[model samples]
Target: MVTYTGDVTPGGAPDVRDAGGLRITKVAVDEKMSNNCYLLRCRTSGAQVLVDAAAEPDTLLPLIGEAGLTTVVTTHQHWDHHRALKAVVDATGAEVAAGFPDADAITEQTGVEVTRPVRQGDVVRVGEVSLEVITIAGHTPGSIALLYDDPEGHPHLFTGDSLFPGGVGNTFGDEAAFIQLIDEVETKVFQRLPDETWFYPGHGGDSTLGAERPHLAEWRARGW
Candidate 1:
């Protein structure tokens, strides 16, 4: 697992590292909301994918550099998460992708057409690297996560606002939504993935499945 115990705040430098065969760069775009924007590049082909255009276009655009953005993925239709979507897409002309149910909302908020409506079992290609789309609805009607299985090592999960460090995402006090989120997370993520799998959440610091698995019961009991 790639351990990064650094400052993840807006205006703070990005945390860049090599995991498996890909280059992963994580930056916090919106400081108050702690929204994390990730850039995943396929080392072999240099094809890049920008995940969640959170905020701070000035900071996010510069990070793209010369690699060229191939695609921009919106984890959900949350306004905070897509605050910089228009700017990034306008700069890179990248294809916009989002969950099927949230496509219309994303398009409305960002003013960029959602070219791809991703769903579970769909594979998003970034050069030769492939990311499997996992729909985990709870935080929103169309919340989704991307899973990249590193052939050389553990898998990498970009879990938007679905799963977090101490607990699952806030369900806005809705018990049914909370139940759905927990069920999907436990069934689709925790139970299916290995302990070493690294989950990069939409906000806050990164954590591994192993580190979080033991606290699943506690999280469920507390019912956040």
Candidate 2:
């Protein structure tokens, strides 16, 4: 009995639910209070990927187990993003993964082994889906996104904190380096994807490449 909720944001898009085939369920945890987390599900195989567990395991662990999640992947080493990471790892014995840069910190915090150290061009096979990893280091020195060709739709890009609906993510690392990384993501990743490709961000409601692509120029012009 998966219940659906309406959009609560002022100008945000309505909540979406995929009832069949490959699906993605948004579990708004501390994110609405601070940051957001998502659970990516493959209906065909009943396997899931937990992205950015921002709350306690008691809050999200049940959902993860219910969804039959197999892997936990972090967008970065930000504390808010991995709040329940250790718990999730202990509960499901799920393999934890993160970008290469934050491998050590993630390892320390979770105390759970990192099964895979992802980088650009690397693919993580989740059930039958292959998510091509895209390293976008801006908000954090180790931020990464997932890009995949969906079997049901055009394509999908799970942009951790690298992108959002209105603008790019925060520049917390080296300001100059972060800006350069933003530029790279805009050019190499976003621009390469089809216009209709979906952008599932880490902190906001979903937006399409067409909706976000035009805004990139504006973001760059404003020195984002």
Candidate 3:
């Protein structure tokens, strides 16, 4: 397997990687916004689940192809994360899923009803692979992360705007919110998962738990 750098640029070809049972394709879209949209396809069943249809249905629909998307999961209620949500769902007739707390806001913003209002423990299946929903709120009321404990290998996490490469996501200067988000991530993610676990963020390159573990205190103290 070639190294999956997780580096993508707008209008560039996607970065694809195989995670044991599934394949993850990270596509950067939306011009200057450069938001990332992930396409998770189950190797066996060919069923696909897209994470954060941020923009450019023109780019995303082609990736979906004829097999079509089974589900479109919006990481949070952020406008930058779901710009092409309505269009993608409309094109593929895919089911919409988002954190339970932010479902209403997503529906209101995109005019797409969240058929699956997933909570922390919800399991979202994409073909043969099952992703456990981990609600890491505070960045947004419904910000969530998806964990696929790849049975054949190490774990893979899809941490939307909440958890990123350098630190937890931007809380918009809300100290209390930052604390809440960090605490949730530390307890639910850092403490529970091993160091080898690789995580994919909504934007930019990915990182492993081991690489970011030592900076927990720095992030907490810095408070951004």
lDDT against the true structure, per candidate, is 0.90, 0.73, 0.93
Indicate which candidate wins on lDDT: 3
**Which model, 1 or 2, shows the larger TM-score?**
1
- For model 1, name the residue pairs that clash: none
Query: Which tens-of-lDDT digit does each residue in 1-224 have in candidate 1?
Result: 64665347887888987877688899997657889999999999999999999898899888898887999999999899999999998899999889999999999887889999998999988888999999999889899999999999889999999998888998999999998999999999999999999899999898899999999888888888
Ranking by lDDT: 3, 1, 2
List model 3 lDDT by residue over 172-194, tens digit each.
99989999999999999999999
Score every model by TM-score: 0.96, 0.86, 0.98
Using TM-score as the measure, what is the rank order of every candidate, best first? 3, 1, 2
Question: Which regions of candidate 2 deviate over 4 angstroms?
Answer: 1-16
How many steric clashes does model 2 contain?
Answer: 2
Could you give candidate 2's per-residue lDDT for residues 82-107 as a string of tens digits?
87887887778788789999878878
Better of 1 and 3 by TM-score: 3
